[model samples]
Target chain A: MIIQKPGIAGTLESSDAQVTVEPGDGKIEFELESAVINQYGLQIRKITYDTLKRLGIDNVKIKIVDKGALDCTLKARIEGAVYRSCNQYNDLPWGGAIQ
Target chain B: MKNPNMKRLRRTMMFLNAQKPGLIKDPYIYKPDSIMLDLEDAVAENQKDAARFSLYHALKEIDYHGVERVIRINGLDTPYWQEDIRCAVAGGCDAIRIPKTESALDIHLVEEKVLAAEKEFGRPEGSTLLMAAIESARGVMKALDICDASERLFGIALSGGDYTKDLQTHITGTGIELMGARQNLIIAARAAGKQCFDKVYTNLNDTEGFRKDVETIHLMGFDGKSIINPRQIRIVHEIFTPSQKDIAFSEKVVKEIDSKKAQGIGVFTVDGKMIDIAFYDGAKRTIELAKASGVYKGEL
Candidate 1:
């Protein structure tokens, strides 16, 4: 639930987003850079916030470099980076926290 | 929708890295019989968890048209396989491939976990099917047990890369070193009434060599092949598809066999070839393959 350390996941592939997360100062700090920022930027931001909320993290600095990744892919990248940041590898809550 | 049939037509099972959204998002466009969403070997060690996240999400959201979605989980020897099973089962994968399977006990172990995960995820108790990859000498020697390990197991596949290493050899392209394992695996799979699949031919440049390898496996009675690329899918399907002549002959043989059996005759000849009850299944299989390949016009 806590972003104890910095964690990063994903790549700058054609249909992927590289997500980076670090501990933030008592509030969610989100930044996004995507190819389709004119159209899907708000949707991408909402997905990141919702995914972070699901994982019980509201106080983290999350940066996303999106290359036109879909909603599912964005969520996966966020979950991956969040989990890695917390060093919680075993007993992953697949459909629970990660969903 | 996820394919429900356990023994459907699977001429090609294309491997895709679960970590790459670009790769897994729309692989069904290539029209492989199945897509092997790999969480093992294809993913780097540090990226295992990341890959699982990608895999779970893809399985949940992606529309694979009619292509079977099979997840290749991490091996049993690692701590990753359990979560891999849980993720794949929760994501509603059509099947889970156990890497480096060596014994019946290994299959049983995975089956137990799969059942538990299925219950936890509220999936049908027996909906999650399984397949094992024989990647070692021990696995090949114990192929029958692996096939008979669980009713959930629909088939077995040869992992040539690792199996060859265990055999103290490398890929010779001629498949001479793999002849024994391939023969043994298909025999075991047939004996257990399960499908058998050949390994991926890694050489992308040698199209001719790939064709020959596919032909050999097709002649050896393999139900399908593990393909690495979309280009290879056509080759496998083409080789596996029964020719029009073969389909026609098979239909005639089936009809003739039925008439002969009705007349209380067990032996006869069709088109100058000796026919008997033993040849009936092979003939029927050809017709079925033709139907699956969309080449059959005869009704028998």
Candidate 2:
């Protein structure tokens, strides 16, 4: 899926990436193939896990394709993807499927 | 080397405590994610010794829960810097904010001294992290090298006041003049795989302008922005947080993607737009922010 926001907050030039997240029965998968990851290693994974756990997602698979994305861009992209997949945008203060 | 379960939610920290007695009490009580008790810029020439003593005692006595304690020592160029480093290390600071770093050599200099002091004081050798304050044009130019200088380095901050003066540029609220510098710093920090922060916005009374500036900086990709006043902390935090509408939309996207994948669908539509693996990635990030900001309380 291609998600693009021409004007977003923060420095958007150097730090941009593509991530892939898939959820299943009590298991979510994530994969990342980011230039940022190739350059900086798996630092963004650390941030992603932290964010997912906090959201109370215990079983997940995530894939990312990074191109030197910043913290905000990483967060925004992951968030947009999760919301789109879960179909929980209409509800307030969402409680995830597993919980 | 990476812990998958670490949250990116760092508290907004403000630097405080100088040679002056009443300065700490000037800002609101119990705010900011952390407070850097500075014996550096805010302290006067004669009061360095006293400030160190006060800082040590304060660390020993103060109960700053949820508030990380950091110390900014005098720059390495000065005679007082060594002693300042020793005192802060001995005083049990969370990190040492080193100033005017031009290269990795500067970080190593302070790291060597800090290590020696840690050994002498029976403190753990790697207990303290180093924060590099990039001031001056040279420092900005070599930020990436300085960031990767040591594993002890945790974060890098833009010292706007000194940087501007050193570059012979005037400071402005719009910060258009500092955009290149800011972008450079962020790029360097990211390249080095470290957290980068924006410089302090000096206009104390211009709360609206400050908020706008924070949003701009936040959008530019900074983890956090420095604050001279307690008032600015909340404003920065608010701007950094993801919105309600954003959270809901992200949730919908994730659900739809999952349902489609279950039916062996590789691609689908959301709101009349094509959806695929890449779209799922952005949706997950929205959920992550919602979780970080306490908007989502679900299973990971």
Candidate 3:
């Protein structure tokens, strides 16, 4: 369930955020660029980190490009990318997975 | 979400594509009586999962604030419908709209999945509801059985495009091609004591034609119409509102009917028009319609 060849998730459209994940240096390093940086930068980063935590990934280089996505859309896109990167397509716990 | 009411005002149920975050996010702002998050014809085959994710979130997060939330799932004939139900239930949508439904089995099959999803998601059993889209000649013919198939069914909607295609006829503004099917479906819905919605008017640009169709369907005894755009909402609601004279006379009849029944008068006359117990329900319903349409300020 560890980072399998750097998974990416999310979209770059307005009200959506795009995230790219890769193997990290034994620590969670987060990078974010958002049109609403002055207002919602921290909120975007927090959503990305929380999604990663729920998916049980402790360390990864996560890049997020935000177009002002709502919390749920951001969460889904990140979750999609993580699952896609790990090649775990079947039996996704769509609502939320067990830790 | 408000608790499911078998009889609710759904004069305009607008369809929003499930995958579009922007559209699904705040369609309630337009104030359609119901918002149908579509996972069937609107979604691309490859994007079903993505659409489900978006749909689940929209249901969970959007505070539609008294607007009925209906999920239009893929047909029972597809592999995607079961999962679609799970997502809809988990997200707590008010009802499931089954597309391409032709028989009672379609309702029963989806009802079983809905019940299973309710249990799996810890939702109250029988909390979710269902309605069918009569899309073909077979569906039109079997509309009665379909409407009576389950108690979860609140109504049946006429899906005109598929129905017309099945008849192999072009849709003229006259609506003659669909007259029989429409009449048969409405009669079936009425016989089952269920609400029926007219088919959508697809010509977005034809306001004149849309107005005529709405007038025709409204007079055909449909409870409502499946409106595709916001521009159509006000007109449908306006047309469906009981007129001042109709509402005033209905109120009088409803009140007099109550007193007459107590006096054991089985029949009477109001304004020289014959009145009886049979007209009581229709009169009460007109008052209800007037109140719902914001046209009645009278104390009924």
Candidate 4:
């Protein structure tokens, strides 16, 4: 997904994938570009956003340029970026989102 | 450049305990001499940007209790490395652990990027330290030059797992194949008057084995071991501390050296070995360890 709305329930869309938000307690939207859309398009897109949701982050917008990243690499990069953006400083109450 | 005497380096236990979000909340509470809030391997790829943001916020928010803070950014070979360095330095990290450094040029390139980051962040020049993780054979070979390439270069580390993989060596706790690399890195770091650290022991269930490995590395002259589990911290601390007898002997050497100097003697014999200025250097190091470890609280 290239763009995601900033709210509890949002729409996610990508070149090869789309998911409807359940409007549940905790859900987030993350979107990114795949440098190698033919090789790692679906898996990279799914994992980048799935990780944030798993971490209980209710809302996010991710833009990934995947250069043939595998499942592991996709997960690593998304987690790295999310943590960095949220952890620019140590005083925020971003406790449950950061490890 | 902020504080020259701050070079009295502490043996740093950089913790890598980020499993769940709250799992690593109070990294400083663990009392690691350094905290490496990892954003590379421990994090997944798609989450790279988010993790970077999280790290930036964490560093800005968390009170790390004077513990030295570092960020293990992705390798320079990756697309994420530049942004990682930029955000890490801008967020006030003391050092950036450059991964997969295979040559002096790799370190030089990273140094340039870090210098730019420093300037961009308007940080004091030379406020950040560059720690190169030599994870390949080439990195080991060029370690000395890498260490000497920049004054901002604080130390080098031996990442055992990747090095073993790069060398196509079998993995085991024995670390037999890594012995040569470990020893060489220590020699290289010491030759450059810099610090060197051993890699993390991944076997969390094998605490005894981990302790033994820490002892081996400590005996081999490593400054410290990168610990993956908090359970392993005490083992590393124990291994790095000088024993009571060793501390006493070091104290005796210092006292004897003082008396001899007072009597106009330049040297003396300890246990039939020639004890000269060189011996005093070792004795002084032992005393410093004792002081740092809180074993020698008296005034020097």
Candidate 5:
């Protein structure tokens, strides 16, 4: 689904990641900041890219401020932001891709 | 993995705000019999849409070990409950807790949606369970009808926070304001063959007060309490543990019943307490609880 506008999910809490998705050009603009960036930064970026791709969106500016969140939390926050951008609140495919 | 049993031990169903990812991730570590992923009171109104996203994902990602996963959705009167069910059932939540349930129709409405979601999600039909929160005097008065409303219902819980507001009264030290409502709810749940839970004790500072309420409700035949904090879990479990005397007496009842069954005798006196087949289940359940609580010393 196409993202309608700027969408965000998660919180600036420990073990969570605050993700924001906004309109972008034909390129995927990704910015990430986390305490574990040096150790898990590449993994986090891959997960974000995979989650965004699974939601069928790529051309968006993604900002991730992670706080030691697990891969599952990252994926969930990313998907949530994607759906919020598209303004789809109902009928969430919970067991969907990036699970 | 136990298929969510209707008669599972639900001594404490702690309410965790679903929007809080940190709290929801590992609440099972405390070993509450159930964890209620709250989507109503704990969540802010503007963030209801956001909370569902987290709730659905947490329910999918977390294993939750053996602790029962319950989702306390918004009331049927609200616009959020149907969508809440869609997320909960798809995530395979063990039970859906309906808030401010006033009548049988409320449960029927949720049941209809739950069935549809189960079908749409390819879950086993009738796998999801439903519970109602009686939040007003009208709901208390209509308790039996509500309890008998749905076959998928495992029980009903009294939400004292809202009920007190509807009555224009407040909680008292001795629980006089809540005693009648609690009695009626337990009776209705028992009559309908469903488990009943006590309302949450809001005061965490008063350990003595909480203890009194727990003991009182246990005697009043409540299966559990909707708690907010983890500190209450140990206290509730300790209170629910079968004492040594209780275990011995229950063991004697079971042994005597087993031996007397050959003689076709259904009634007997165990330690001068009249016991029969009706008491058999209670006796066995005591032994099971004793074993589970690690207080049982007998070989049998």
Candidate 6:
């Protein structure tokens, strides 16, 4: 799905990641800010990219302010932000595209 | 299509915000009989959509270790309840709880949407059970209708916060304000053969008051109570579980009842008490509660 506008999901609370998705160029632009950056940075990046790919979002500026969120939480925040950006809330593909 | 879990033990149904990753990630550790993933009042107005995403993933990926997952959907008045149903059904939640249910029609509307979502998502036609939260005077008066609304409805719960507001009173912490509603709801649910749950006791600091409230509800014949904190779970379980002497007496009652029935006796005294068929189910229930609470190791 296309990122029609900027969308954000999640919180600065501990064990949550604030995900932001915005329209981008022809390629994916990724940025991350997390306290556990040195330890689990690569895994977090992989989860973000993998989730974006699954949602058919190839070109978007995705940023996550991670507070030690798990893989499932990161995916949820990404899905929430991506869906919100497209102004789509109903009839969401829960296990389909969002998985 | 009958729900086997209709009569399961639910001494405590803990509420957890669906939007909070930290809260929802691992609540099964506390081991409440069921976890209510609140997509309703617990979530902010603008965050409802985001909460659903969090809920769907949690339902799909989190292994709750057999703790029942009941999602509290947005009320019927909201535009969000439909999508909330779809997301919860598709994510394979065990049940959907409709908040502020006033009549049978409300349950029918929710059941219709749940059926459609189940079919659309390829779940079994009646796989998803439902619960109704009676939050107003209208809902309390119509409790019997709501209880008998659908075959998928396993129970009804009291949401005391809004209920008190509708009654033109506030929670007095003395349980005086909620007497009528609680009595009426339990009677309606029992009359309809559905389980009834009491409202949450919010004063966490007043453990003594909480225990008294729980004990009162338990004695008043409520099957369970809604809990806000894990600290409340142990207390509810402690009060709800049958004592060792009670369990032993129940076991003897069951055995005596069986033996007496085979010998063509209708009523008999057990331990100098006037025991009859009327006491049989109650005795059996005590034994069952013991077993469920992990305090019994008896064969019968």
**Reference-based lDDT, residue B133, model 6:** 99
DockQ per candidate? 0.88, 0.01, 0.44, 0.08, 0.62, 0.87
lDDT of 1 by residue, B182-216 (tens): 99999999999999999999989999999999999
- Least well predicted 10-residue stretch by lDDT in candidate 1 chain B: B1-10
Question: True contacts preserved, each candidate?
Answer: 0.93, 0.00, 0.32, 0.10, 0.54, 0.83
Candidate 1's displacement at residue B51, Å, is 0.2
Q: Model 2: runs farther than 4 Å from truth?
A: A1-99, B1-8, B20-29, B251-275, B279-295
Work out candidate 3's RMSD over C-alphas: 2.6
**lDDT tens digits, residue span B8-112, model 5:** 788899999998888988998999989999999999987898788788778888889989999999977788999999889988899999999999999999999
In model 6 chain A, the worst 10-residue window by lDDT is A90-99
lDDT of 6 by residue, B146-228 (tens): 99999999999999999999999999999999999999999999999999999998889999999999999999999999999
iRMS of each prediction: 0.7, 20.7, 2.8, 11.5, 1.7, 0.7
**Per-residue lDDT over A44-84 for candidate 4, one digit per residue giving the tens place of the 0 to 100 score:** 65665566665565555445654443343344345444434
What is candidate 2's lDDT per residue for A1-99, written digit by digit as tens?
A: 212222111122334445455653465555666555565556787777765665666565666666665554455455535544554332212112211
* Alpha-carbon deviation at B92 in model 4, angstroms: 0.6
* Higher-scoring candidate on DockQ, 2 or 3: 3
Q: TM-score, chain B only, every model?
A: 0.97, 0.87, 0.95, 0.92, 0.93, 0.98
* TM-score of every candidate relative to the true structure: 0.96, 0.68, 0.92, 0.74, 0.94, 0.98
Candidate with better TM-score, 2 vs 3: 3
Highest TM-score among the candidates is held by which one?
6
Per-residue lDDT of model 4, residues B1-300, tens digit only:
443523444455565622223433466776667777787888776556655655664566566787788789888777888877877777778888888888878878888988888887777778888788899998898889988887877788988888999889867878898988998899999999888988888889988888788878878888887877667777777778888888877877888898998899987887666776667888889889888777885556
